[model samples]
Target: MTDALQAMKALIEEINHHNYLYYTLDQPGIADADYDKLYDKLVAMERETGIVLPDSPTGRVGDQLLKGFDEHKHRARLWSLDKAQNHEDLTAWHTRAAKLVNDYNTRNPENPLPPLSFVVELKFDGLTLNLTYEHGRLVQAATRGNGVVGEGILAQVKTIKSVPLTIPYTDGVIEVQGEGIMNLSVLEAYNQTAAEPLKNARNAAAGALRNLNPKVTAERKLNAYFYNIGYTDGLTFADHREMVEFLRENRFRISPFVRYFDSIEEVAQELDAVVSMRNTFDFLIDGLVVKVSDMRTREALGYTDKFPRWAVAFKFEAEEAITTLQSVSWEVGRTGKITPVAKVEPVDIAGVTVQNCTLNNIGDIERKNLKHALGSQVYIRRSNDVIPEILGKVTEEQDGEEIVFPEQCPSCGSPLELKGAHLFCLNRLECRPQLIGRITHFASRDAMDIETFSIMTAEQLYQELGVRDPADLYGLTFDDLIKLERFGEKKANNLLAAFEKSKQCDLASFLFALGIPNTGKTTTKVLADHYRSLDKLMEATAEELVLLQDIGDIVADSIVSFFRDPVMQRSIERLLQAGVNPVSEEAPVIMNAENPFFGKTIVLTGTLSSMSRDEAAKKLEALGAKITGSVSKKTDIVVAGESAGSKLTKAQQLGIRIIDDEQELLQLLNG
Candidate 1:
């Protein structure tokens, strides 16, 4: 029994250390398979002995579903910070804090506080988490409920690998405050394969934490950043910097940025700098947090009824606002998906006047409880700088006119059908909007690379030239194009040249131009590389497709169904007849095993002067290289070009191999 306990203790400590290294430092001490073996051994030992250590790593994987969250009283109150919308508001806040500090110093001259220095950190847009540790062991984790109390979510919080199960600080009791967030890159990766894509990272993190199933939370792979030791029974610090060091010593995952500034003017300048590079961060941040550096000054400044006087949140311009929904219009996409576009009263958000917001579909409208929200105030947000989307109605009781869902296609008057969370019109060929959308997408830069092509051009060709399918574009001549309303001699000749140039496209571009449902550029590229020809891809079975990496059942089904459709087959026949020749230019007769880039995950960033990045990627793929968008520890090499940005910097920081010279890149491609 003693030997078993000792073995368990050793295993627990080793596993916890590895978790910290991998999650907090982004440095893996061991391979995943090796770590799993150690974990399996520990689990087997635990089961055999029927004894689990208090700080056992196995507890991170919560096997049982929680019925409900129990209320927990926090050791220290989680205070909210006062917000500063502009520089004026921030200046006023600093003035108030300085005044309070001066008054305190005057009264107690012998014990005068330090000069009013400030610490600035990013105000992460995520769920506030309070983790309570007793005798260095994490005992409880909770949400910030009314400052004084919170709902215990220990099981859910444990799933975060960055959060230490046991800290080096063997304090009596302590509460650490941090924000839990899902990285934007992680969110994008999740959305790619997820059946129901998560709308935003902030909401995704919050929803996962509050979920009844810890398994669901684990799947999200959330991360956290500890900023403050909210409560401590056996620790003291001279200033915020010292406290930060203590947090770091205890193996808490802190943000890389914790800049200290003595002058308020410097702090303001720093805020501006942060705003400029805010998008570069992997996580989402709404603003910067300016806090008093001196702990004694913070104590002297004290707290107000709602917010702490020592700190202020320098908030960015509002990205979300409530606007009255005037009407809803259903628009048809290239895939026949009917999307609901809500025309709202013009409201300014993040400096843009938003009059229209997306409701996604009828199902999305119903899911968001916006069925009876027309003419009512609806909450809208500009997600990822794209078109603003309607979150929901402000009032849940629905005190306005009902938003009627269209039973028929608005463009072609065909019967609409619900497939999952979207409404689809089966009228593919005749629908004006659908045909126009299809043609526009087919001529897009990433697809057919048809220069000077726009939605207006597609519309003109459809109406004036009697163009329907993408194949019709190939048949267009100078005489036909010159007859159009906007077509002059030069414009007609340029359009004809572009059309001719696009006919000799590569297979990957041609496949992407087809715009198969549930498939994007990446998947189409994969399909092209795997089959090496259009006929082979068209003949591929779902079973064979699923064998390819990243190609799931849904995507495979979408591919198979699209090619098997008689309409699509007829369209392809017409395209072939019109002299459109899409060749597999990058297909190697025999893949070389000795190639340096073979089987290596490579990333391309910035502008390549020799060739387009897409063209370079295809050449690399032919030599058996896998190209990814983002740079991470997993990335083997980064092919950087002129003016490489954050990705290049990250690659350098991670010590990944970089190929920056254009001549070197050209040699590699040619080699």
Candidate 2:
């Protein structure tokens, strides 16, 4: 590497660390004056050398934002790693790895393999960014949109101080891939000036990098830490750990924590250690990336199209945080249920700021004794991006005070009633939260399919137009919407069009939209199949409901209770009066029983030539095929593509029929 290039790499790394301290962790260890001096020196050096690296921060200086992002084809495919959520899955994967290694050793007696070892690193929860450097100079950067082609954010990425502008060149082109994310500290700073609350660090980094405004991306202060050296012209390593160490030596921002183990059991221990220390890092991590250490072994194992065969990700189940609950506040649901929401100190969990956690019901609070104490530390769990829930109170100081459940409606102050593990506010028509929540649900995608409707819009309709129930939504006219604050003629027309489109939703979806407690999509389907229409299902007795498949006593009673409520009856009548007629589905089209695939559980793997996997699954589902996620004892068929891996092996062992091509898939579905 040239002297200028060496200095540039060092300067870039120094600047990146400074950025990490200030922008990422919100702890600037160095003074602004000292940082400014280093930056000036870098600019002067760049000018003297007349060699501006592609990822040089100097290029970002005074650079205007591009009008739009353009697509850049990745030089190499960025394959995803297969994931294992539990020990059993990981053990299964490890067994497969052992088998492959044993087979390789058997094939080549002279080069017998050692016990399969792995290198583990934190699996960052963020967008994948590929930064390519040619002859030691950073040249291009792209988002890993579809593995092959990604939106170009070269200009935006140049502003990331942590990305090296140049490196020590000894070989051909180097493609470095990393997780690009805005940490919680950066999110806090950005939200201060942003018009909206950024959902999380990962999304914020993705959106910031793709923003048309380069300055905006710079202002957000994105960070990245390289994990894999995806492609190289002439570089080779005996193992993954050596290659990563080389990357670190060359001034790349590699992961700080790296460990190697000879056994899967040892790797599992490391995984636990990583999870325990995950929150202490500046970046967001969702799991641990475990890779077969030997490069030769990796080559022997090869890869599947969707995932690398030599590596797997042990993903964490949930993001949790312990925070003190300050007090309890009751909020009335659409069903007139007054649920407790524990207001807590703002805690970060699952990358989002949670100020309050749901207590479910009065019965739940009494059972857990959460409301019995204020200023008590509580376990808040955020699962699958759902609302945070207060799991239970944690042991803390004895000064915590007892919580008193409210006896009246939080919104309307009406006397509350107790009914089987729930506290209800009988003022259903008047409670503001109930009205808004119900209207929001009714207009939601799964319900009425009103795309233009939102919680904000629902609140406006209820407060301004007195939308007492879901049915009143149909009465909204363009003229009425035109009077709202942000709604103009075009917005009004769009909302009206959405409403008109929703009037045609089928019986199952409509039934689910009623917001019946404990009744989900499958329950709605069962109900629709049995009764054929909404009114028939509503008129049925609890005994009739209990007779159906999967319908138990509690669900039956809830269904009956909802239908018998006078307010609910009036709501349905209003919906009928508004011409919101739900069409019943005809008897399900019976697939020929003679078809071999009918009633068979099947799993799909790898890329198919004719159509996408999702499209294939839909067509097969229509023909009575059950699409499954993994290969198992119950899987009757396996669809294998060019690079199908572990699942294919499992299917072969189980002696299941393996379909090879899209043509075969089409034949099976058509027959």
User: Best-fitting candidate, measured by TM-score?
Assistant: 2
Shift of residue 110 alpha carbon in model 2, Å: 29
> Any idea how many clashes model 1 has?
0
Q: What TM-scores do the predictions have?
A: 0.48, 0.56
Q: State in Å the error of residue 327, model 1.
A: 1.5
After superposition on all CA atoms, what RMSD does each candidate show versus the true structure? 24.2, 16.6
Score candidate 2 by TM-score against the native.
0.56
Model 1 TM-score is: 0.48
Candidate 1 stretches with Cα past 4 Å from truth are: 1-319, 382-384, 589-671
lDDT for 67 (candidate 1): 24
lDDT of 2 by residue, 1-671 (tens): 24454455445444544444433233333333234444555667766865443224443211111224676767667886776767887898889888998898898888776778888888786768898997788889987754666768888899999988988864446788988888788888889888887866766786778777899889889888887888763455778878888888878788878888888999888888777887898767777888999887887787753467889878776556888889887666665766666788987654456675556566667667565568778887654323456677786344578777778777899998877556778886778987897788777645677876777899988889988789898898878889999998998998998888888888878887887765656677788888997878889999899899877776787789989999789988888888888877556446878877789898877668888777777777777889865665668999987656566877899898999877877786666
Error of 2 at 647 (Å): 13
Error of 2 at 255 (Å): 7.1
Residue 251, model 1, lDDT: 93
